[model samples]
Target: MNDNHSSSAWSTYSRTVFIAFAMIALGLIANEHRVHVLGILPWLLILACPLMHLFMHHGHGGHSGHSGHDHASHQAGPVQPKKEADDV
Candidate 1:
């Protein structure tokens, strides 16, 4: 039982050490690539605009599927309110 406990403790300790080293390595890599990443940030943002518009409009059923709206009906005349008897 003690041996099993020791093995489990060793595994957890090794895993912790590995994760710490991995984080340090990632930090170093990110620091090294910071300039390149920043240079691409603008292009990434520009690309994101069309992607966001496509995805966001998809969630709202898009512009092509307007079921009840009639475009031609709105073109005929300016809307005038009915004259009430009290107004005259």
Candidate 2:
């Protein structure tokens, strides 16, 4: 049913948002304090992961049909043939 479908969609969306926020939170915490061991690198990397994902996945809306061509140039009449004057 439509209701079930919508519910599932909402749940998925909520989960994704939660995970995104959690990643940011962890990153912020890591940035606040330095870890003595090599583990800090991995933690910072984890924080950057979500940002990379977002930028890589962001979508631009579809383009209109007019984008590819120059409408004005097409509207102009075809080039006229040039007549050469006869040699005197």
Candidate 3:
């Protein structure tokens, strides 16, 4: 395999492993102690980052409604023949 491909693959693998470890650590910490007023909000934010990123970046941009208006103008308004059948 090319070096670029190998490097990208390794990077993706490392990112996945890092996220997994973070989630596991969060779960362990949350489970071991009683919920606290200060920790609650921050923990929620930490858990929500992935979902917020998914929606803000990946989810909304995939919809084509924003570009559909451009397509409407390109369509032929109506078919018109140069000469009527009676003219032939």
Candidate 4:
């Protein structure tokens, strides 16, 4: 393992880590100011709902309703052999 190569590889991620921490700090600060934040909460919720709907539920939304498997004709119970006593 080369020391310089490992350092250079990880150095590329330094900015991403910094940005992630900055966003977390900003969220914490926003959380501290709940009175002001509450006013914007409604709009954020409205905006987030559709974004979540579109992004999170894409698995169900994008696919055609038909998967290859048929559901209706699936057997639910065990098949019992005709009992000898039932015919009477």
Q: For this target, which candidate reaches the highest TM-score against the unseen true structure? A: 1
Model 4 segments more than 4 A misplaced? 1-32, 61-88
Q: Give the RMSD in angstroms, all C-alphas superposed, for model 4.
A: 8.8
The lDDT values for all models are 0.80, 0.72, 0.71, 0.74
**Residue 1 of model 3, lDDT score:** 54
Once superposed on the true structure, which residue ranges of model 2 sit more than 4 Å away at CA? 6-10, 35-88
Residues 14-55, model 2: lDDT tens digits? 989999999999888877665554667788899999999878
TM-score of each: 0.60, 0.32, 0.32, 0.31
lDDT tens digits by residue: candidate 3, 1-88: 5655554645877989999999999988877775575668888899899988877775343356556444543465977778757765
Question: Cα deviation in Å at residue 38, candidate 1?
Answer: 0.6
Q: Which stretches of candidate 1 lie over 4 Å from their true place?
A: 6-10, 65-88
- How far residue 8's Cα lies from its native spot in candidate 3, in Å, is 6.6
Candidate 4's C-alpha lDDT? Answer: 0.74
lDDT, residue 29, candidate 1 = 99
Extract clashing residue pairs from model 2: none
Across residues 11-87, which tens digit of lDDT does each residue of candidate 4 receive? 65787998999999999998899788798989999999889987897554225564664444343466678867766
lDDT of 1 by residue, 1-88 (tens): 3655553645877989999999999999999999999999999999999999877876443246766665665446987999878865
| All models, RMSD in angstroms | 7.8, 15.3, 12.1, 8.8
lDDT measured at residue 60 in model 1 versus the true structure, 0 to 100: 48
TM-score-sorted candidate list, best first: 1, 3, 2, 4
